[model samples]
Target: MAISNKVYAMPPVVDANSRLLFLGSMPGTASLAASRYYGHARNHFWPILYRLHGAGVPDASYEDRLRFALAHGCALWDTIASCERKGSLDADIREAVPTDIPGLLRAYPGIEVIVCNGGKSYETLDRHHGMHPEVLRRAVLKVPSSSPIPTRQHKGLEEKAAAWLAALSPFVKPRGDAQGG
Candidate 1:
């Protein structure tokens, strides 16, 4: 059977009030199949998020997880709008069309911080989204990938989560009244 290569069919999980934006390169095979970001069971995205913000469970429902991130002033999207790949690996990607990041920033002016989940997204943004003046103005944090696929550097979960937490610190809204009587 011939392999289906086109990827990136899901809409971004973003809202008008989002102050922080998390960008992945593109949805992986698991994410596309499940129609959810970071759907691969072994991916550390959820666990890192859960560790950073104690309010949500890593195993929470998809909608609930989206709600949790949105409620906390964050948004999620991919750098590549579409790409052709034989598998889930970023190295296999080809003909990647980047998303309208500048448009998104314009639509949501409140977005003050942008964080890239991995190197590909960061590189994509630099190559494709860097032309816009507004995009160039904002700093993009290129954190370690949370995917289960090991990197040559091999940063531990705690290290990656720490870096993510540091990058997200400025935008994270204070958890209010959690200890209420």
Candidate 2:
């Protein structure tokens, strides 16, 4: 049987200095249950971040993870404000209502790049906001999802991490930036 339920996304993890916004499609089952993004222990999202910047992960509390991300000028959010889905799988999503992308960009004026965590997120944003190519052209980037579930589409974790790091590097300030320029 298909489990149908409304899923809500967490508030954007943002700050005045946010320079990059990472958007996922929607919170999965684990994330929704924990009321935290990427709460699943097997998920590579947090680990990837740690690998990129050598920040605390695999041990730090959820709050600390958020602090580290924000301190590095990275913002996290999901594209769909709400959606009906059976499980964590993005394919099961239906009747997706997108978050206010324009409002977010306006509110976080420091955001210079937009990174979609997976194809679902990129597709959702494109479907809803593709009409304005000019806005998207500014930086809407697509990156592999950090979910543990693997697929033929993505090679492997290492490849995915490399792509993510490359895409995010331009927008993410160097680690030394945290020490102040």
Candidate 3:
């Protein structure tokens, strides 16, 4: 038996030390129900994260993953603050309330890059939010959708995705999660 969360996508947690930030559009049906990020069965987020670190995500708790991300100077967040989804399809999002990133960036001055978790998140940021050729100077790499919704490989896109994660790997160190506090 699984519970369901109906409000919105859970915000990715990070501490002051996070150096990289990952942004998705919103929580999918699976994620929302689990009250966790990237809960979809087919979603490759876990695998990709594990691959990046050359190990598993440490534990089942999202907090643990956040700790891993923080230790590696990485942060996780969604592109949309709120949205109405008939189910989990990003294409089904009706009215999206984008998150205010500049504010978060200011609070945590260490973040160097913002990686969009999927193509939808990427398009929303690039198309709707006015992050264009100039805004993309920060390097908004459109990575593969980790969603298990469709397993069809996105061709050479995986290489770019792996590279993006690799760029942040040097910072990951053996550190326990801060959630205990």
Best by lDDT: 2
CA lDDT of each prediction against the hidden true structure: 0.81, 0.82, 0.66
**Tens digit per residue, CA lDDT, model 1, 127-150:** 987778768777778888888876
Residue 70, candidate 2: alpha-carbon lDDT? 84
Tens-digit lDDT track for model 2 on 1-181? 9555888889989999888888899988989899898898878888787667755344469998888788777889998999888888999999999998888887778888888999999999888875664346458889999888886776667778888888877655556565646
Please give, for residues 1-181, the per-residue lDDT of candidate 3 as tens digits.
8553334657667778776678888887778788877766666776677666556534577667656666666677887888766777887887787777666766776766677877878877766555533344354556666665543554443663465466544444323433332
Off by over 4 Å in 2: 1-4, 56-59, 153-155, 177-181
Please report, as a residue range, the 10-residue window in candidate 2 with the lowest summed lDDT.
Answer: 129-138
Backbone clash count, each prediction separately: 0, 0, 6
After the best TM-score superposition of candidate 3, give how far the Cα of residue 23 lies from its true spot, in angstroms: 0.7
* For model 3, the run of ten residues with the poorest summed lDDT: 172-181
Off by over 4 Å in 1: 1-4, 173-181
